[model samples]
Every structure is written in structure tokens, then in C-alpha cells.
Target: MKVTLERTDLLKSLTHVHRVVERRNTIPILSNVLLRCDGGQLALKATDLDLEISEQIPAHVEQPGATTVPAHMIYDIVRKLPEGAQVSLETSGDNATLELRAGRSRFALQMLPEADFPDITAGEFSHAFTLTGRDLRLIIDSTQFAISTEETRYYLNGIYMHTVTTDAGERFRGVATDGHRLARAEVPAPAGASGMPGIIVPRKTVGEMQKLLEDPDAEAQVEISEAKIRITTGNVVLTSKLIDGTFPDYGRVIPQNNDKTMLVDRDDFKAAVDRVSTISSERGRAVKLAISEGRMVLTVINPDSGSATEELAVDYESDPLEIGFNSRYLLEITGQLRGDTASFSFADAGAPTLIQDQGAEDTLYVLMPMRV
Candidate 1:
């Protein structure tokens, strides 16, 4: 196989495909990327058993063939090569050595047989839809932070995706929780997704898809089967195995009777929480929120350190209530709000508090209170 590619184009493809290769692998072939050259394009693929990414880039093909090489090694070599250098790769028939040349530098790298690479297979998708990159980014960023990191509850380690009917129309909802906090976001459901089964997209897949959606104007084609999910955009394709677990009924956890309400500037609330958290205990980071008629105060206390309190004018007319929460949790949820004001509803000091961005109807958060 002999091919020539510009440094910039080759690096872009390598960076995208290399994300699928794990730094360490139990199988040698799994650590390498499969490169196939034919008809003026080079196909690069890498997989880590659970997720696979493939991309094709334009290249000058002198001789068409296929081979496997160390993914990270090749990426590093190409990344460090002189800018605008023309890269040339050549390997003789049945040979395990790959010759790489660029500028005044040359290197011979070992290659693995292309036949050794594992095939990632998926069944026929029951649902396929298209979402603008912006909509997909909102759904992912709003919920991914709340996904559970606990290994035992494997079911909660991913975002739950399904179609739901709202007053306006049908929409796709994404929900995630770690038992303490929950985040839910919705976007207009793409056509043909009506009867699709709810699926839990694993944590790693969420990250890879987020990276692939960096172009806000690009559209992504999503295909969902019972056990697999695939996302394709531009010249790239990513396939991942869905987590094999049932997500809990998240609707039940969202409170409906919480009537007491407080509206405050989102940035002000976030800043106050950040300031008071300086004195919060390291283990729990608990901060107390005291709300009353037109006033809200945030305070944190630590036995070894001291205490901090900050007051802010708010729009609240409910009975005076005091609630405690983890400072980090409050800050994270508040930071996600897109509007200037954050509206919070409460049942009491002991029940879960519902938080929503005042002008955004597509997202909401629920946080269980902690005893101060």
C-alpha cells in the first residue's frame, strides 16, 4: 500500500479516530487503527470493544491496500511533523513493516494484519432521526453532568433517551440522576422517532458524541436499536453498545405539589453559593438556604473552619422556609441555567426542590435537601 496525504488533513482524521483507541489494551490489535486506502480516500477505524469510530479523508493513492498500525504512535508522529509536509506511506505485500516519509524525516513502524481487527456489528435500527448539532449539544450538556458514576447502579451511569408527548407536540427527553440530583431536558422529537424504545446511552458514548458534535451548524444522523446506538455526521461515524440495564421511572421522582416558589438572578445565586462554600465542610459541603418574603440568605458552617452568610433580594412570597443543600450541587445546576433568573419551587425543608431556568422551558433540575 502506498498513499500520500497532506499533514493537516491526515492529522484531523487521526485525531478523531484515535479517540476510540484506549491507551492500554489486553488485545494487541485493539490498540491499533485499521487503515484502508482505495480510490483517492483513506478509511481509518479504531475501536475499544464498547465504542467504535470511523472516518474517511481524501488522500493521494499511489497503490491501494490495507494495514493496521499503532494508533497513538502514528498520531504522535504525524502531529509533530512539519506543517504542510506531504506524508507518504508504503508497505509491500504481506509485509509487517510500514515505511513513513515526510520532509527530511523517515521511520519504519510495525504493522498488524488487518484481518485481526474485531468487527463491531449492530442489528437493524428501529428508529432513525436527524437533530441539529445545537439541539443535540443542549440535550447532552444539560444532563450528562448528573449521570451516576457509581458502578453498582450501572443503570444510572448513562443518560436515558426516549420520546414523550407534551402540550405543544412530541419531544425527545433526556434524563440523568445520581440519586442526589437529577437533570432533565427536552428538544423537539425528530420525525420517525415516535414509537422508539427508551435506551440508556453509556457515559463513554455520550462523551464521544459530544466531541463529534463540535460543529454547531452540522446535523447528526442518529440510529437507535435495542442494543446499539450509532451517530453519523460529515465524514465520521460512531457506533456504541448501549448499557444493558433498565432506567428507573424518572417521572415519579419529579414533584408535582411543590408550591412555594422563589425567583432569583441565576448568576447572583451562583456567586453567593460559591462565596459561602469557601467555609463549607470538605466532606459534605453543605450550605443552608433561608428563604422568606422578598429575601434569601445563603450560609455555610464548618466545625474546624467557621461560617459564611450572604443575603440577596429575591422574588418570593411563600412562608419562610429553610433548606440545606450541597454547595457543589447548587452551583452545578445553577451554572446550567441559560436565562438570567432561576426559579425554584419547594415543598418544605425536607422534600426535593425543583429548579428551572425562568425563560427556558426545555430543562429543569431536582435536588434532594440535606440536613444542615
Candidate 2:
């Protein structure tokens, strides 16, 4: 393949596709990116068997052809080159090496047969919909933190996506949980997603897809089938195999009758919990939350270390209650709240506590209390 492309443009495209390439590979072709020059564009593709990413960038084609070259090495070489430098890439014969040139620098990179690269076949998707980049990013950032890293519960290692209709109407929802905490968020459902089947998007795929949605103004096209899911935006496409196992029914973990309600400044509460937890090296970083008529106190105790307590004025009228929770879980849930105030509802110290963003009911967080 012989093509001439600007260094800045090439690096930008490589930045997107190179991340999908595995750093270490048992198969030789897996470490290389498939480059195809056709129709005034250079298409770069990379995959790690389970996930594949492809990007097309504008280029001047001298001799149209295709070849495979090391993904990371080429990325680094182009990245270090002077800005706006013109890059020329050409491959000699069938088994010949790949030649790269820019100004006074030139290098010959080993090439691999393009036929050895694994290809992911696009499946027949039963449902396809579009979402704004801002909305998609909200769903991922709000719930991805709660996805479990536990290998045994493979289903919980991804965000669960499906369509649900409230008493009002149908809405698109995303749910994620580890054993200790759960997060759920909803947005307006797309026109054709009414009967879409629920799917667990694996953790790695969620990350890669999220990266592509960084442009808040861009829109993403999502396609889902029984076995896999695909997301496309601009010149980029990402496809991944869905986790086959079933996700736990998360509704049961959310408490409905929690009567005690406490409203506190979100930042203040986060700061208090963060400070108090520092004293308790043991007890699994537990911090006790004591709520009374109009005051809330955070306390942490460790015999070998020390104890800490901080008080803050809150909006609570329920009976006094004291509950223990892991500090890390509390911070994660509260961090997702974009507003200034945070509300918590509790039944007792042993029951799960429900958290919400003051007046917003569309998003909810549930935390399992710990025994102190």
C-alpha cells in the first residue's frame, strides 16, 4: 500500500484505533493493524478477538493497496514526528517489508499478510437506535463505577441496558451493581427501542465505547443482536460479544418503604465521610452516619489508630438513626450526583439506604449497610 497523509491526521486516527490493539499477543497478526487504502481514505482496523475498532482517515493514495503493520510502533513513530509533516507509506512486493518516510527520517517495519487478521462478522441486529453523545456518556459515567470486578459473577461485570416503561411511558435505562452498591439511571427511549431485549455490555466494551463518545455534540448509532452489540459514530465503529450469563434481578435490592429522609449538601457529606474514614484503618473503612432531627454526624473509630467525628446541619425530621457504610461506596454514589444537594432515605441501620438527587427521581442509588 502506498499513501501520503499528514502526520497530525494520521496520529489522531491512530490514537483511536491503537488502543483496541492488545499490547501482548499470542497470534502475530493480532498485534498489527489492518490498513486499507481506497477511495481517498485510509481505513485502520484493530481487534483483540472479543472487540474490534475501525477508523477511516482522509489520505492521498498514490498506489491503492492494503497491508498489516505493528499498531503501537507505528503510532509512536508518527507521534514523535514533527507536526504537519507529510508521511509516506509503501509496501514493496508480496512478502516485502513496509517502508515509512517523513522528512529526514525513514524506517522499514516488518509486515504481515492481511489475510491472517481475524474478521468480526456483523450480525443481523433486531434493534437499532441513536442516542446523543451527551446522553450516552451520562449513562456510562453514572453506572460504570458500580460494575463488579468479581470474575465468578460474570454477568455483573457489565452495565445492564434495556427498555422500561414507567407508569408514565417507556424509557431507556442503565443499571450496574457490585454486591455492595447499585446505580440506576434513565433517559428518553429512542423511537424503535420499545421491545429491545436486555443485554449486559461487557466491561471492556463499555470502556472502549465510552471513549468514542467523548465528543458531547456527536451522535452514536447503536445496534443490538442476540449475541453482540455494535456502536458507530463518525468514522469509528466498535463491536463486542455480549456477556451470555443473566444479570441478577436488581429491583429486589432497592428498598421501597425507607421512611427516614436526610438532605445534606452533597459536597459537605462527601468531605465528612472522606475525612472520618481516614481514622478507621480496620472495619473495612466503615464510617457511621448518625442522623437526628436537623443534624447529621459522621464518626469513625479504630482502636489501634484513632477516631474522628464531624457534624453538619441537615434537613431531616425523621427519628434518629445511625448507620454504617463503606466510605468508598458512599463517595462513588454521591460523586455521580451533579447537583448541590443529596438526599438519603433509611428504614433502619440494618436495611439498605436509598439515595437520590433531592428532587430528581430518575436516578437512584442503593447502598447495603455494614455492621459496625
Candidate 3:
């Protein structure tokens, strides 16, 4: 294949596709990206067996051909080229290497036959819908932090996406949990999303889609089936295999009868927690919250180091309670609240605590307490 394209255009497209290729591959072909030049555009594709991304960029095609080359190598080369330089890619006559040239610099990359690349997106999708980038990003941001990293319970490693009929209307809900905490966020269900099967989208797929949705005004076309999902936005397309295990019914963990309610300034609470946790042991990293009628005191104690305490005035009228929590988890959940006031409802020192933005009910978090 022979093609000439602007360095900026090529670099942008490469940045998206190269991320799908794994750094180490058991299969030889998985480390390479497939490049095809034809019809005045250059198409680049990369895959790691489970997930794949492909992008098309305008180019001056000198000859219609295809080949595979190291994805990271080519991306690094194009990224370092001088701004506004034109890049030329041509295959050698011996058919063993791809020659890349820009200005005074040149490099040759070994090639694998394009036919050896595996195609993971060959099946039909049963459902398709369009979502604005804004709504999609909100759904991901609200829950991605709670996804579990443990491999033993593989089902909790992704966000559970499904439709529900609420009192207001049909809603699409994204739920994620790590046994220690749970996050649920919802948006009004888009058209053509009704009757879609509940699917567990892997964490890696969720992250990749988040990166591609940088344009908030753009629309993403999402297609899905029992086993896979495909999303297309502008010049980019991503397809990923769904996690096979069944997600646990996360609703059971969310406490509904927590009667104690505490309203505190979100920013003040976050700062107090962060300050007190400085003296906490790295392994434990636990902070205790002692809440009374109208006052809350945060405390952290380390066996080897000293102790720290901070107090904040809150709006709590319920019975006094003391609870312990992981400082890192507390900060992450608080950061997700968009409003100035953070609403915390607690059942007791040993039960789960429910947190939310004061007047917004669309997103909720449940955090399991730690022993002080």
C-alpha cells in the first residue's frame, strides 16, 4: 500500500486505534495493526481478540493495497514528526517491510500478512440505538470507580446495563459494585432501547468508550447483542465482547430504611477527610466519623504515628452514631456529587451508608463501613 497523509490527521487516528493492541501478545498477529489504503482514505485497525477499534482518515492513495505492521512503533514515529509535515507510507517491492518517511527521517517496520489478522466483529446485532455523548459520559463517570478489580468474582468487573420502567418513565440504568461499595446512575431511556437484553459491559470497554466520547455534542451509535457491543462515533468504530458471567442483583445491597440523615457541605467534608487521613496507616487508611446533633468530628489514629482530628458543623438531627470508612473510597464517592450539599443516610455503625447529591435522586452510592 502507498498513501500520503498529513501528520496531524494520521497521529489522531493512530492514537485511538493503537490503544486496542496489547503490549504483550501470545499470538504474533495480535501485536500488529492492519492498514488498508483505498478510495482516497487510509483505514487503520487494531485488536486484542476481545476488543477492537478502527478509524478512517482522508489520504492521498497512490496504490490500493493492505498490510500489517507494529502498531505502537508506527504511532510513536508519527507522534514525533514535526507539526504540519506530510507522511508517506509505502510497502517495499520484496513485500516484507513498510517504509515510513517524513521530511528527513525514515524508518522501516516489519509486516505480517493482512490475512492473518482476526476479525472479532462478524456477527449480527439484535439492538441498535443512538445516545448523545453527554448522557453516555455521565453514566460511565458515575459508576466506573466502583467496578471491582478482583478476578475471583469476575461478574462484578464491569458495569451492568439494563432498562427499567420507573414512575417517571423508562430509564436506562448503569450499576457497578465491588462488594465494598455500589454506584447506580440512570438516564431517560432512548428510543430503540426498549426490550434490550441486560448486558455486562467489561471495564476495559467502558474506559475506551469514555476516551472516544470527548466531543460532548457528538452522537454515538450503539449496537449490541447477547455477546458483543459495537459503538460508532464520527470516524471511529469500537467493538467489544461482553463479560460472560451474570452480574449479581445489586439492588439488595442498597439500604432503603436508613433513617439518620446528615447534610454537610460537600467541599468541606472532602477537605476534612483528606486532612485527617494523612496520619492513617497505609494498609488500613481508615477514618472515623463521629456524628452528633449538629456536629461531626473526623479522626484518624496510627499506631506508629500520632493522631489527627477535625470537626465540621453539619445538619444532623438523628441519634448520634460513629462510623469508620476507607478514606480513599470516601473521597472518590464525594467527588462524584455535583451539588454543594452532600446527603448522607446511615443505618448504624455496622450497616451500609447511602450518599447522594442533596436534591438529585438520579445517582446513588452505597458504601460498606470499616471497623475502627
Candidate 4:
């Protein structure tokens, strides 16, 4: 293909598709991006067989053709070139090589036949909806950190997205859990999403899709079928196969009726945990929280290393309760709170603790306590 595109435009599109291209691939074509030029636009696509991303950019087309070239190499070449430089791309004579030229720099990259590149078809979707960029980002940012990396429980490696009708009515919900901690967040459901089937969106696709929603003005058109899901907006499309396994029934794990409530400054609690955790044991990273009438004390006792304790005033009036939890889990949960105050509900040291933003009921976290 022979096309001329501004460096900025090409770079913007490349940045989105490159996330799907793996650094190493068992199939050579998996490491390359498919470039097609036609109808006054250029499309770039990349896939690792599980997830695929494609973006179209405006270009001056001299010839209508298509080819595959190394994804990372082309991205680097264009990224390093001077800003506003015009990039000219063309296939070399008979050799199936692609040449990239910008100002005084030029590079020739090995290319493969476009026919060898895999294209994932837009599958049948039973449900489709539109969401603003801000709302879409809130769904991902709030729950993505809880996804599991464990390979055996493949179903837990993604965020569970579905529609739920609460006492307030139908709402779109996202939940993620790694057995130790769980994050659940929801937003008002769009018009046609009632009774939509729940699907587990794989971790990689969640990450790549999150990046695409960074534009404040962008709106996403989401389509879901039995086997795959597609999200498209502003010339970029991401398609991925949903995890086939069923996610664990997360409701059973969420604490039901914990009554004791304690509200503390989020920054203060995070700082105390961070300081005390420094003396915690290497393997457990455990920190103990002792809550009394109106005072909360954080203590870390590592018999082999050292001990630390910090006290903070809190808004607890119930009987004293002591709980131990992994410091990392505490930090992650606290970091996600959007307001200045964080509330925690406790049953006892052994029971699962429930956390929430002081007055917000839509988002909640459940963290299992650790034996100290």
C-alpha cells in the first residue's frame, strides 16, 4: 500500500493497536500489524488471537493495497521522528518489504502477505448499549485491581459485568474478586440493558479497552453476544472472546449484615498502614487494626524483625474489635475510595470485613481477614 499520513495521526492510531500485539509470538503474523489503505482512509489492526484492536486514520492514498509489518518497529520509528513530519509508506518492488520515510530518515521492514493476517469477525450480538467515557472509565478503574492472576481459576481472571435490578431499579454492575478481596461498583443502566446476561471480560481486554476510553468526549458503543464482545468508538474497535467458564457466585462472599461501623480519614488510615507495614513479616505483610470506643490503633508485630504501632481517632462507638489484614489489600482498597472518609464494618476478627465510601451504597469492598 502507498499512503501518506501525518506522523501525529499515525502515532495516535498506532498507540491503540500496539497494545494487542505481543512482543513474542509463536505465529510470526501475530507480532505484525495489518495495514490496509482504501477509500481515503488507512486501517491498522493487531491481534494476539484472544483480543483484537483496529483503528482507522485519515490518509492521502496513492494506491489501494494492504500488507502486514512489524508492529513495534513501525511504532518506534514513527514515535522517534520529529513532530508534524509527514510519513510516506509504500511496498518495495517484488520483495514484499515495507518502506517508511519521514523527512531525512528511512527504514525498510520485512512484510508478510496480508492474507496471512487473522481477522476476527464481528460476531452476533444480542445486546448493545452506549455509555459515556467517564462512566465507562469508572466501571473499569473501580474493579480492575481485584482481578486474579491465578491461571487455574480462569473465570476469576476478569471483571464480571452484568445488569442487576435493585430496590432502586435496574443498574449496570461490575464486580471483580481474587478470593482474598472483592470490588463491586455500579452505575445507572442504559435504556436497553435490562436482563442482559452476565459476562466475564478478560483482564487484558479490560486493560486495553480502558486505555481507549481515556478521551473525555468519546462515547463507546458496546455489543455483546454469547461468545464475544465488541466495543467501538471514534474509529477504534476492540473485539475479544469472553471467558467461557462461569464466574463464582460472588454474592455469597460479600458480607451480608455486619453492623459495627467505623469511619476514618482515608489518608490517615492509609498512612498508618503504610508506616506499620514496614515492620511486618516478609511473607504475610500483616498489620493488625485494634478498634475501640473512639480510637483506632494500627499495630505490626513481627517477632523476627520489629514492631510498630500508630493510633488515630475514629468514629466508632461499638465494642472493641481487632482485625488483621494483609497490608497490600488495605492499601489497594483504600486507594480506590473517592472521598476523604472511608467506612469499615466489622463483625469480629475472623469474619470478612465490609468497606465502603462513607455514605455511598453503590460501591463496596469485602476483604477477608488474615490470622496473625
Clashes of 2: 0
Number of clashing residue pairs in every model?
Answer: 0, 0, 0, 0
Off by over 4 Å in 3: none
TM-score of 2: 0.98
**Where does candidate 1 clash, by residue pair?**
none
Give the alpha carbon lDDT tens digit for every residue of 345-364 in model 3. Answer: 99999999999999897899
Misplaced by over 4 Å in model 1 are none
Q: Which residue pairs clash in candidate 2?
A: none
Q: Which candidate has the top score in lDDT?
A: 3
lDDT of 1: 0.93
Candidate 4: list runs displaced more than 4 Å. none
Residue 300 displacement (Å), model 4: 0.4
Give one digit per residue, the lDDT tens place, for model 1 in 185-210: 99999997898999999999999899
Give all TM-scores, in the order shown: 0.98, 0.98, 0.99, 0.98
Question: How would you encode candidate 2's per-residue C-alpha lDDT over 153-259 as one tens digit per residue?
Answer: 89999999999989858999999999899999888998878899899999999999888998999999999987888899999989888899888899999999998
Q: Rank the candidates by lDDT, best first.
A: 3, 1, 4, 2
lDDT of each: 0.93, 0.91, 0.95, 0.92
Which has the better lDDT: candidate 1, or candidate 4?
1
